[model samples]
Target: MADQEPIALLLLQKCAQVEAAAGLVTAVRALHGPSRTAPIVLLTEAEAKTDPKSSSVDAAIPIHCPADHAARELERWRPVSLEPTRRIAGILGPGPIAGMIERLGVRLEAAMGMLAQERIDQGEAHRLAGLCGTLGFAQAHAAWLDLSLGEATSLAEARRTTRLTLAAIARGL
Candidate 1:
């Protein structure tokens, strides 16, 4: 149900009227509570020059921009999923905990495959490391850090770390 919450507010600006868009953004923020986490994105005409940060909008993208660029902007505004920490579990109930663990295991397996192929990027490695820590897989977190920081010396070492991390996940501790 958390995913059902509003991800963002998208306002369409016709004819390059940034002032109107800004006003709408202000109204939206006021109505939704100024502290709302959902970002407001303005879609403007190609020639419209809007500075989103100055107007309280999270992002402004031209309607004519490339699809990938638009998608990237939307993704930038997407809310990050809450980690399955004890506090979160208490609030959201225990049902999500098992699901989170399963998801983390799947992600770790994928990361290990990427590591084997030398295709894992530092950003992904760092993210996985954080997830491991959140899930209480300390050794896996350390191994992820080693991979992320280039501290692991060889492919064999990386494989070993991956196996160890998998084992930790299997142990469910």
Candidate 2:
């Protein structure tokens, strides 16, 4: 039998803001569902603070990592069940991941351009970081983490770093 597309289960840990949440939505929407649906599970420590409502998520799970609630859920809930012929290819598999990167291309360029004109928001920066991780671009992800999470001193610097890193990721893709 042909290799069935692998099932994907994305577990996102820290999605607090609406814009950051929207980034996840944009990333997952790139999948558009196929032979099997890739479900997104949102986990948060501060559920009250984060608001846990986004269009892209299949399920929102509120729990403190390493805490009882999270442990119990991990024990009870299975992420996926594959048939004998099918296996898990992961969300970062070549086809879906490449597609996601392509989808983000226009947005990334536009965001970089906008950053030149005005200060970009944390959400936008974080969104780029999230996408980098999804694409398995570790260096790009680290650069984005530094910029979005305050390692960079200025927005301009972050934008410059992002643009460069995005080019690297595009080449790798």
Best by lDDT: 1
The TM-score of predicted model 2 comes to 0.39
Q: Write the per-residue lDDT of candidate 1 for residues 1-173, one digit (tens) a residue.
A: 22334423454555566678667656554543212334555677763443322345434688898999888866644432333344556776667766877788678667756754566588877888787777655555777777788765533344444444444334332
- Candidate 1 Cα errors over 4 Å, as ranges: 1-93, 152-158, 168-173
| Clashes by residue pair, model 1 | none
For residues 1-173, write the lDDT of model 2, one tens digit per residue: 01134233456775458687667656654643331234455676655322222134444557655577666654433421222101112533567655766666656666656555545566777888787665554444665666677664545344434444444333433
- Backbone clashes in model 2, listed as residue pairs: none
Clashes of each: 0, 0
Tell me the whole-model lDDT of each prediction, alpha carbons only: 0.57, 0.51
